[model samples]
Target: MRVIDPRPLPPGVLAAFLDLLGPERAAEVRAAAVRIARGLDGGTLWHVNSTPRGGGVAEMLHVLVPLYRALGVPCRWAVVDGDERFFDTTKKLGNLAYGSTEPADRLGAGAADDYLAHLELEAAQLAGVLGPRDVLLLHDHQTAGLVPALSAKVAAVHWRCHVGVDTPTEGSAAAWAIMAPLLDRADGVVFSVAHHVPAELAGHRVAVVPPVIWPFAPKNEPLPDDATRVLLDRAGLGSGPVPGNVVADGPRDPDAPLAVQVSRWDRLKDMHGVLTAFAESVPDAHLALVGPDPAAIPDDVDQAHWFATCLDAWRALPLPTRERIRLVCLPMDDLDDNARLVNAVQRAADVVVQKSLAEGFGLTVAEAMWKSRAVVGSAVGGIAAQIDHGRTGLLLDDPHDLAGFADLVTAVTGGAVDGTALGDRAHEDVRRRYLPDGDVLATAGLLTWEIT
Candidate 1:
């Protein structure tokens, strides 16, 4: 196990919430923080996950952990060390949990033994660092195996699951069957939504805490129009000299309407489907499918393969369609800089879409919405929970409907719908539901439940 030094953020960052929360709600937030602080009795809150930089889990911890500390709660973030084989195993389990029909050759007894062995090493390391009064929050399927060994070492253990399928499948059932037993030892379990809780854990203490976004975080922070253009240029999506970190096919058409989807190069994210839909129907608009550089996330062993496959698919498209689509790989060396680039990309987008086949909670959807950009997302998993379908944002009922997805995109780009009005409402929607104020109160409630 390795401790990740969080980027230093001032305690006064909470002051940014004043106008958004208003006087009364802001006062309520401060009071909740005070009460949770008293309840902690000086116990440190610890978060454990697979990586510290690439995906949504890391992003959330990066933002929320600092905010918790700023609010006077003692907090620490840790990333578990795993080899390629270990991550491959965990990634399979993750896909299964997300209801992927992909074969689970890695979930057998031998795989279980390997998974447990790795967590055992991590548990021993964590045991030495954690005190008797500290609370541990294990995140996702990656760290679920630590529950039994570490439960006795900490004051309390809570597992936070960030993925789920709206409908259960055989794959999901099998994955839960294996995980439910390990998670039984946790003091409580937290899910992004109630449907994600397995039937096997019916009597367990479960809390539905949706993920949150920090409005002030680099990824969601407000960027001026000029600054956005310059960042895009530096990242090689425009006329400026291409930086070593970015991989782009050609310069983007600044005059053409831009539609962006920022996510990992994962099958479920459906980046290819987005490409196909863009090429076939949305003729004039440029689509930028943005993701982190594959080499950065060592924990995801298949990232390189997935990214290579995506690149091949892009190359196979017709010349004109290929020119309209930009496949961007952002560098992860400086996370803050990477986030700023993402913020600029999203801010410059005419419409942001998340055409995910399955999702735990689409933080990208919330991140874009927080920026007050119009969004169209598939009505599945937490995306459905976040979008109200034509009110806050548009939701496609079927994720695989290529024609339907294209029509929705054209609707916004063609001015058939008021994208700006939808974006304004989306900004308010994200403010109401997916901000840290609610996240803190709800999470603090979970901690209080565990401690008492």
Candidate 2:
């Protein structure tokens, strides 16, 4: 087996691609990323997931596969396709996986049967593109069914589960049963956190690999102050006084506190709960709800009804209170700009909020912390794992604790709590633990170990 070295890549070719971090931390992550890339120099890695756009899995792979090839590995990424019926079924399966009892009758009965059939068809279509000995990595539940179909030809198959899997309910169990055979067919399973691995797969060749943020990547890095100004202007937020600044600019008065929520507008993300908390908590603070309109919800469904309810909730507020809340629904195609805007918001805001009822490792939390911003997240799933509470960041148990959340927000923004210190610690924590280069390297190590 060839042991590829990560060094010797020309300067500026690949280094320019990573998100920016503190100098020492950036060097450490770069070295680790290079090492991981080098390990698979002659290996071919295939990553398959649902949807080519609009979600974290696809976004991560978009940047990740290229980094692999640049570092000398042969890599390819493919999206699994299905019609509206297929997606609707799979979407319910996702909710069930997170402990929802929603019946996936469409997905569970004939739709699931058809989905598997589609996978078999997809497998045949991909046969020519995939090398017989390539390491096939299937991501999430959508593509999990593909395993049994492709098992015979691949060198090793690894199922990467990105969500939490505590004690699953009956609905989840049924979905798992349909998917279990495919999982059992794989050489091993990879989970973002140890607790997320289903008990049945616990004793198998399981690897606990956390998702990582590529610091040098466009979406994750800090923009120049000028670029930040441009983004704020475009967002209609006008040049306001940034939290630490002496002068107040347009709508963003530097003296007032700024609180931000960056997540998909999905019910699982608990955007409604976030609004409720903010409404009761700090009326003086400027709140921005930022993210592309969620793609998970079907278009024909009453998505508009939900949005209207949220809008009505905000509008029903007294005039003064309503003015303080700004709900921004971003376009899905503008993810890069959205990411940069998020970085800018982190820099400008005094407190960052992620009140998710359920989450798959909440990369936005990591991204906020990376920007040296203090975060108050829900104590569910990986959010608890990411925050150290009163140290790196705060974790709220009852996301509806309006008063408590407000107090924390005021404490941090009022200079009573050291927001800067918290952000600084968060940056160090993410750099040491969650950088993407390290994740890829660790993944490569696991794959190599399994295959060899």
Candidate 3:
């Protein structure tokens, strides 16, 4: 197991929220933080997840751990080490939970046994370091197995699942059957939305906590137009080609309207579907399908495969279509730089799209919304919670409806949808609902319940 030392943001960062959250909500958040600090009573608040990089969970924790720490709570983060087989099995379980049609033959009783054995071995080392008063938040299926072994050792064990399907499938049900027993020992279960809670978990105390974005994080920070241009040009993300990180067939048009979808190269994110939609319908604009380099995220075993799948889809398009599209992999050597680039890209985009087949919560939707960019997302999972159709952003009722998606894309990018007005409302909505303060207060509420 590896411990991640979160980089500290400036002191008094949360205090700035007084203006953004309004006096009443900000007071509520501050009061919750005070209560949480008192509840810990000198005990640590530990967060355990599979890795500290490469995904939304990591990006969020990077901001949140420090936020809690600054709020005077003893917050710490640790990563559980896993072998290749461990990650592969966890990925299969996640895919199953997402209701993916992919095969899950390996997610059987034997695999469950092996999974628990590995987590138990990892828990032994963790249990030794934990105090009796400490609270543990085990994130996603990757760390769910730790609940049983560590539950008795901690003050409370809260298991939070960051992924789930809108509609239950046989595969998801089977995956939950294996996961439910492990989670039964947990003091509480947290989900991104109510719909993500499986029926199997009905007996457990469940809290639907929306995921958050740190507006102060480099990824969400404001960049001036010149800085956006300089960074994009330096990274070869814009029209004037300098040596850069983006992978594309040719140079982009400097003045063309751009639509960007930034997500992991995962099947559920539907990068291929977005590519197909853009090529077939939105002829006047350029699309950039951006994600991290597959080699950077070792835990997601399917990244390389999905990246290739998108590559194949991009190649199938006509020369003219290919010219207007870019398949991008931002460098991950420096996470802050990567985030800054993502910020620039989103800031540069006319419309942001997240056409996910299923989502726990599309944090990207919130991030784009924060930037006041018009967003179009599939109405499944937490995406619906964030985007009020025809208001803050747009939503597709069916994810597989590529033509409908194209029409929506055409509507937003072509100026028929009043994207600027939508983006303005989206920004305000994010400030109200998707900020870290809300996430922290909800989590505090859950932890307080468990400890009581």
Cα lDDT of model 1 by residue, 1-452, tens digit: 99987875765667876567888878777877787677667778899999998999999899878887887888899999999889988988998899987764337668877998899999999888898888888999999999999998888899999988789888888778788999878999999977878787787898888899888888887788788878888666666765665545567777999999999988889998998899888979998889989889977777777677878888898887888887788888999889999998888889999999999999999999988889999999899999988888899999999999999999999999999999999999898888888877876787677322
Local lDDT at 191 for model 1? 93
Write down the TM-score of every candidate. 0.96, 0.85, 0.96
- Candidate No. with top TM-score: 3
What's the lDDT for candidate 1?
A: 0.86
Which 10 consecutive residues of model 2 have the lowest summed lDDT?
A: 1-10
Model 1 stretches astray by more than 4 angstroms? 104-109, 241-249, 450-452
Among residues 3 or more apart in sequence or in different chains, the pairs in candidate 2 whose N, CA or C atoms overlap within 3 Å are 18-216, 18-217, 19-215, 19-216, 19-217
Report the lDDT of model 3 for residue 54. 80
The backbone clash count of each candidate, in order, is 0, 5, 0
Instruction: For residues 286-324, write the lDDT of model 2, one tens digit per residue.
Output: 777765554443321333444556676777777667667
Residue 343 of model 3, lDDT score: 94
Question: Could you tell which candidate, 2 or 3, scores higher by lDDT?
Answer: 3
